[model samples]
Target: MRQLNKFTFNICPTVSIHNQINLLSNEDIKYTFNDFQKNKQIISCVDNFSEIERDECHIYFCPYESKEYHKITNNFPGGIFIHVHEIALFDEQPFEHKSFFQISQSFRFMKKLTLINDKRSRKLHDNNEHLSIIKYPHLSQLDLSEAQDDYIEQFLVDTKTCLPNSFYLCCRLSSTEKSDTTLCKKYNMNKLFKSAFVMFNCIFQGLSLFDRRFNQLRVLHVNSSWIRYSSRLTINNTENLPNLKCFSLYCDTDTVVYDELIVPLLHRMLDLEKLHLYLIIGYKNTFIDGNNLKRNIINHMPPLNIFTFNIRTTVHLHNLN
Candidate 1:
């Protein structure tokens, strides 16, 4: 009673990890798992355990409706089990890669993840190879947008998962460049995909608007009839987009998606800032000519600030009746 046996966790070091922790009828989670054995990264959750009743400093859990799985307890030292930060892996089955490497070792300081399994995972197409590569070293933010697509080839296919560095990904599939005609397998979908967040009717199939392997692409919104038939490529692979700023295209008629692939992909994005087009060009009419739209795309984007255009042109051949 003299301060309960001299316990001073610097004054309640935040201990609340329950959703299933009985610890033999829970005496305040067995005195908060024996003062967390002298601090273990202030564990918030998921240290991945389902068996630990040793009673002398081993209380890992899995109590609710327990079917038990992991047995963690070598007197503690598997990196004291990573402190779970934030993880969301909703399932209705199908989650292979050994349940994503046991949730990357029970959420090792996971940053922010949200996956809503759409069911696939046949060992991600059965070439298991002893499955390893699943690491989430302080992951940034990853929402699979209702995942499926084998979880986008199981985390951008860098042999299965190892993302970081500005890592922020939100997904919502589309063609996914299924034919491989210069999609280069979506540049293996990872080279930091510039913090990817694709899916505006996403269709960049048959590559066109520049790709020095996505040269750290910034942002591109496409759906202009599948990019007006491969948006006129071949000017040395459309020169330098140099980390394209931000762009959008939403054509429905296409006089070649605005004077030939949106003015040669906006003169190779000379560091474009932002521009959105809702073009419907077809009657040609030179894109409402204003000195050829200021010498072809407002003077080659001197760092365009923000310009939205709906300056349309259409005879609406209406997709040929």
Candidate 2:
């Protein structure tokens, strides 16, 4: 005689497939929703998925389905993992499903989740209220530079866990914004841009809006465009970051004001230990040269007995590629 043990459970989707064979009989297997008129148990199965033990299930689906599973598993030990590609399939459900309130309730338990794709569903997941429950001490790594700024910013805001000690971010501003480039009349493009100075000021303002989550940041990197926008003006409250120790900035062009903006900001970062900068082009031939840039910044930034400052300038090359 074979004895079945109740505690030995298979919670993986692959294992669930095998269970489906036993749980659903030949008659029930034949009744797909498309042919449900012939048999009603399939609909009963879909509607009453809760009848299964909370600890005996695992679901694999896109963000929306993952969100639904989160709602169902809040009391269960394991959480759901999102698959970015299949989200649209769940989203394409007949109009009735879109209006279903049960789906919304199902998403309310979504927390401590890992987003798997660059899709908008990932963005929506970041905004979910349950995100703050994410346990930071257990987090191994996170890569957010490729994510949209709105998602990236909100994720940091919702992050209750200290950021991992090491990570990589490759952030670049969108090049097509009329405000960053030129004015145009055909698309009312000039109005589209809020003006470079205003956009620049907003970068400085964002630091204030940056929530206390920044206290966990130990190392920070910024591309030239981020500097162009965020460095256009210096922020005043940087002293709030108690753990910050290293900073790096890449500049598109050698601009003296970059130093001006950075010096004052660094003055507030007392724990700063190392600073590095890469410039695409050396300072525009003018009164300020590398020597002046070094002297002026050293006078205002946080004191450093041992640190490395290196600058690389690039020039237009002929067809090496």
Candidate 3:
């Protein structure tokens, strides 16, 4: 490790980005790179990061308190691209949307980013569900393990930030030592590829944790009511488990219809050839008729071969003579 000479600089709080996909207004890249100072702590730069211990290769901007402590400026530059791989942002100040934009401007290829702020986020002006979303195109792991309440809204809120496609963010206690799978997926992480998921004993909060589709999954059996997110899968842009061939869900009693929860879930199984549903359904506005199966569910799953379901629906006849 070569001696890292500390260079000081200053950076604007908010940077304007034009090409940031799914983000704010398009106006060419208006970000500027100013020179580093001799004796200041506004912005800091040290470019000796290389896999093989080289010089002036990877630039890492990590801002802290002064809203300038972490900005990675390129003074001794080989090229414009700053290859910051791992970053740990520690600050006492509350992080706002601008804080992310500043990071996103330079760390386009950052793999692992850790945020260490306990304070909440201050909402930006005109913040809404339809606002431009800040996207991290190549970021694979974001360790919000030390973030807090306002961080959830700043990161998880659909309108604020956009992670990679099929990205699933899970939050467990940082102290807990268990790895739980997403709602739609549960595979052994140690084993890269898994074919079947069969659990007829324990009931999980069905579809509540399902975020991404399982393409390699062929069989899934669960003892679950399977009613949550029945109306939200499509809206959330959840793709189908395309390769699933067999699915069996058994529920003791549920008040959901085939249209709402059951069929919407089945529609995701594009390649499913066999299905078995044991459901005791009651008190729904609509009953599961043959057409409901044929048009709503079956029509979507083109390769469906054997369709079997035991459903009982109780309907109330009103104003009968």
Candidate 4:
């Protein structure tokens, strides 16, 4: 068997080349480039001019190391996954001294882009003048979970020209320390939600519920913190997300006041078929009527087939009907 015909390259550190090849043979493999130094052997083997083939390939890179993968992206044009940590890295020049935006522009055939950020990762700084200068027209799915508020804003501003069909944003609570709280206040969650809706209209179909524009969005996810500060921000209009089918929200803290934010948001997603919520109720003196809330949810979103909610110690799941 020809090597190019049988093997798929994976730039992950945890799995060996043999194991990756075996996994690739059994199922489609999504390569995550975490530590390139550790995978040098596999990289060298696949780097051979005869073995490398230009087929549909997916590449995932750590935000800071996207530069490292630029040299090899020519052979992979299917998609790119960027795990964003510090926004500054994207601004830095690497591999022939090209910025990430310039390097990304080389792959016009690329169709999907995934941006990921987690709580443990450092927050995105307020200054994003350097990032978000380019747009990928072929992307169909754009996921920006646990990203800094400024980063998302900059992305929306830059990519307003191109809208993906699926979009996701997950917000985690920052520490309540005075310094962090001050920074969080600068990036209000309410404004972020509002901007997301406005930008969604610019790229894809207009929001269906509002009859403002066509709705091409299908999947949406939001994970937020229940700190007292976020209580004021409500996802008041579900009509803005009429086409959404799968919706999930994980509330990090225990607070009933958050119900004010969640309930109204649920009411607006009338088209949702799947719903997941990690809620905190009755942790201390605060209390919420779970049964009544559930009934209200059912009444509003009649099309729901899968409903799951985790309320502190209790979990309720309603499977497909």
TM-score to native of every candidate shown: 0.28, 0.40, 0.37, 0.46
Best by TM-score: 4
74 Cα displacement, candidate 4 (Å): 16
TM-score of 4: 0.46
- Per-candidate Cα lDDT values, in order, are 0.56, 0.36, 0.50, 0.41
Give the alpha carbon lDDT tens digit for every residue of 6-30 in model 3: 6433333232233224432212111
Leading candidate by lDDT: 1
Please provide, for model 4 over 123-207, each residue's C-alpha lDDT reduced to its tens digit, 9 standing for 90 to 100: 2333445445465555433334433334444444333224433333333223333333233334333322322222111111111
* RMSD to native, candidate 1: 17.0
Which is the better candidate, 2 or 3, if ranked by TM-score?
2
Indicate whether candidate 2 or candidate 4 has the larger TM-score. Answer: 4
TM-score ranking, best first: 4, 2, 3, 1
lDDT of 2 by residue, 1-321 (tens): 246322222123322333454564323533433442332222111222332322132322222222223222212222233421111112211212112223223232322223222334333434444433433332333333333333333334334323334333333333243332221111121111111111121122224322233455566665544343333322234545556567665555444444445555555556767766565432333343567655755554565544555555433344224
Instruction: Residues 1-321, candidate 1: write the lDDT tens digits.
Output: 545633323111222345335533334545556655354433222233223212322333322122221322222223323545565664456667666677677657778778876667766666666768888888777877777766776677647678774566776664344333333444443265564555423454323535565567677555434444543334235667688688776646444445555677678788889988776567533336577667988799998989878766655444444
Each model's total of backbone clashes: 0, 0, 6, 4
Which one wins by lDDT: 1 or 4?
1
Tell me the spans in candidate 4 whose CA falls farther than 4 Å from its real position.
Answer: 1-98, 114-133, 143-149, 159-216, 227-240, 283-290, 313-321
Error of 4 at 311 (Å): 1.6
